[model samples]
Target: MYRWPFISVVLIIAILLVLAFVLNLSIGEVWLNPFQLFFSENLQSAILISEFRLPRAIAAVLVGSALSLSGLMMQTLFRNPIAGPYVLGISSGSVLGVSLVILGGSIFSAEFLSSNSAIIIAALVGGLAMMFILLMVLKIIKDIMTLLIVGMMFGAFATSVSSILQYFSPGFQVKAFVLWTFGSLSKVDYPQIYWMISFIVLALFFVVLSLKGLNLLTLGTSQLEQFGIKTKRLHFIILLATALLTSSVTAFCGPIGFIGVIVPHISKKILKTSNHWRLMPVSMMIGAFIMLVSEMLTHLPGSGMVLPINSVTAFIGIPFILWILFKPLKNEI
Candidate 1:
């Protein structure tokens, strides 16, 4: 499988992430000289690095990993080359939960502190609840395409409900909800990064350990059963993993999309095999790189207007999905 090349690609992606991290620490509306970030007395630069750049950079990398891994697992589970984090409406559910907090938060402004934890807790509840519903639907439907459609419809329903809520919301509350839907890596601060990092690390450790099972599944259901694989148990495990990672990103970074969907396709094409061992880590690196690239696009210096990270990601993810749909191979990874 040319393991050396796979490792080389990951190393190169990691190096690129380091470079982006340094560059991200430097650039801002008040440009800090790259050299001056370290070599000069620019306290403003130091503060920017500590406050804005560092958190955003860390969030970019973490969100990217989470989304990418979730997508990879979904594709493997659904046997759909294009399945991503969005396929299950998990992120939309999280969005709905956030909307509840934003719109209704001011109703208790005298006790806003109580609402902060409520917001995140509500998001987790929404996401896991949706996941549970999807699992039950999958059991009944027994058709992959049907399950996919059900997820889409469920997400649409959540969005509709959220829209109705926003209609009656205060102006600032609506505005806050809108911005949160668009997705932003810069919004995550230092206080939250520790939990985000710790959770993602632990989740990914289990996911990576499942690589062997994932690899075996690529041989098809008959082989997997022959190998004593409990199809339903594994199914739930992967879905739970997907839910955990997706919920984490949606909770913290507001549903950063595309990394989970398209990076796995790119990984499959690059690795030229369905083995999870090769695809998993590579997908993680590619996801992070794509995120760094999109983050730069969002803050492009000359544009005079910042673009949403979703804008750039949709551009990348949509094309890959369309390509997969319009022209497919008998064995799609």
Candidate 2:
């Protein structure tokens, strides 16, 4: 089995993240040295850095880390290797929320949904609602497989509703909703990035507090109970943290996928341990690194065409997923 010391893994991923961050900022329409651009006297270069590229790069890091952490926590909570915000329908809930605002013309005014705040609020509300429902279902359903099925049903329901809404929506509103569904990093600006940072920071605090509880959880509820851990409360706090992390990303980035699932698996494989202490930071750094690289790929230098960030991730993700499905699990992390 491949393994590295915890510090070495973190340091290596951190360095990669830094390089990828700089590389992401340097790509796009015109290749410019980002560090040079920052100090350059050219107002045009300054505007491009400060107003556009910088925010997009930061948003990529933020979205990647949030989604990765969310996936890790959910996998731990469910004790399922394949569990994630996207697979479990949490992102679908955010989509439902946004749909109500953008596609539900009879309910929410187009002018009102036009504001970024409204869209963000809608996403958070919808994601939290789904989280709450899943928590309730957890209380009644002891089977993890059944719980996952319920989550998929909820996601399907949300998607079906969004489709129906789209069917009746004005062409402009539908187009706007469709574009948002494509997912984006450039769509997030400075103000939205500030909000995303706040949400992720708060979620990370909860995660730090829940670290021991999460470790206990991986050992099973009986072990946690024997250790005097309050399982239900811990579950709530962890799920809440996941919801906050996932909702913020989906709200701003339009539900980017695969990072949450892939990063954790890769982290586990490299670390060869289940300790949350090591798993958390490594997963985050790896996620951010992947996102930055994905962003750079989406905007290849000298290519006037820019691909949707979601499509790039899917291209990276689908192969990894197929590998996981077919790969031998005798040494599974």
Candidate 3:
């Protein structure tokens, strides 16, 4: 049997990514030719491509790659196959923060929560706060399963608080919050997309720098210490990078889930290696492709009906998670 080279596999994924991107740009309520989207004279077509679909498609790429990278880091950090931002409540923390901004009007300043910047800050603070709490818990509890339960509890608490806030919030505010919870890529426009790109790129840079350290981490902290690597600093960098990527996507894309958990596993299975050098880029491309496909599906093409992005992801994620749960755990990492 013959196998394709790594470079060949990457090139194939790149071509698929390009195709997915063009299809995402073209498929919607009213399909438009990808070529005409660029040079067409129609004002409506220009607006749809430039102002709406383009941003959403780009956002899909960013959200997918960011969440997948974050998930990979988390799985590496914890050495758990199922650990992800959504499963661990980091997204819920972000949701709590955004909820405060959108629904906690009586507690927060009405003027402040109106800006996109404010929402981003609120999400970062909330996500980091949750992460800090989890780390502290990890000190007392070495068992990953217990920590996972704790994370779920934290998510539940955050959701409960958000629910209470919604109870008292104005009808319009409640509606807005509910809509955001549905998780739509369409909510992200040009300005928000720019912020997402900047944050994800920053996180990607840090991940690239720390790839070697992360690989060593898989052997254990003591192994890193054997080589004179600063374990604390490396761990901090990975945690911070994951937080930034996870929070930025949640802040803009409304807590899109499962991309983080599923993408890493898929990448590892395809590449048949634990090496981050190959794992990272492949996971990112696969993630972006999955997200673009999900977005296209959510649009329902000719039916003119739209599905929530989260729903589409959940359909894919739930079964995979069940499979993971039932599979025997191995020392793969």
Candidate 4:
């Protein structure tokens, strides 16, 4: 299913993802070294490492994997290089659902449930609800461009809904919502990171199984159906996986951008092929690398204050997006 040469690239990206995890762990405010684990005297250090940095680092890794894989699925399913997790208003829906819990005007205060996991679960449901709408539209309208437009308009509609909620929300709630928009990986704590990783891993396992189908779909729909592929069923499965993966990440980490939309394109360019068997892991590595680097920048000594994760990502992502606009690929489809 994969060229031997492409497999090498996938293996290299795996190594780099591992290194990115290490870098993410080492450079946080409470800086740590994993080798100190055996020294009982360094128990405090271990606590700081395990309780704080590791969870946040793990959040970055899982969120990165979620976004990257989501992007890969979108690009393949939509048959459009520019498609991303946010395109379908899914994240906007998640944010709006969580905003009700966060923005305590007493109406939705009880909804908070005082659990990060609950908040995440709420957001996931909201995102999936929106995704289901888009999938239904896909069934009704077979035009890819039309589906994209629908997703965008749906996002605008979601934003309007969020704005109305914000109007009645307390100032503190609005501030919290604003912070979520900025997006920080630092919100993850020791205990909950495990859950984030668990869901992300489960979602991705399903996506990976669809790699062969993804490759066939990339070759074009008719070609896949010619080989007895059930295009509609495959599309639903992949889109559902994308919705699950993206919803989980955006629910916890807020709506991250750039890397998801751009990373797959970069992977395709580097691998010189449209093979998802190679592309999936490559996109994950690049996404993880981007997040880890954003995490590292938070440790810049003289910056005085840490920058927002989404801010750094958007800054890095936009230029590449412009480059993509400037240099169209010869045979992207």
Best by lDDT: 2
lDDT (10s digit) by residue, model 2, range 1-333: 556878888888888898888878778898888678667888987888889999999999998888989899888888767778676688899999988888885445656675667877898889879988988987786555566788899999999999999988888888888878888899788999999999999999999989999888777553466688876667768877888898889988898888888888988888888899989988898989999998888976677788988899999998998887788355553
Q: Report the C-alpha lDDT of model 4 over 16-131, residue by residue, as the tens digit.
A: 77777776766755555645543537778777667777778778877776797898888787777678878777888787677655664334667444356666666777787888
Alpha carbon lDDT of each predicted model: 0.77, 0.84, 0.83, 0.75
Where is model 3 more than 4 Å wrong at Cα?
Answer: 1-3, 106-121, 128-153, 170-172, 220-223, 327-333
Worst 10 residues of 2 by lDDT: 105-114
Write the residue-wise lDDT of candidate 1 on 132-202 in tens digits: 89889867764455777888999999999888878877787787778877888776787778877776877
Model 2 TM-score (2 dp): 0.92
Candidate 1 wrongly placed segments (more than 4 Å): 1-4, 106-118, 135-150, 302-305, 327-333
Q: Where is the poorest 10-residue window by lDDT in model 3?
A: 324-333
Q: Which stretches of candidate 2 lie over 4 Å from their true place?
A: 106-112, 138-146, 220-223, 331-333
My TM-score estimates for the predictions, one after another, are: 0.87, 0.92, 0.87, 0.88
Clashing pairs in 1: none
Give the distance in Å from residue 37's predicted Cα in candidate 2 to where it truly belongs. Answer: 3.4
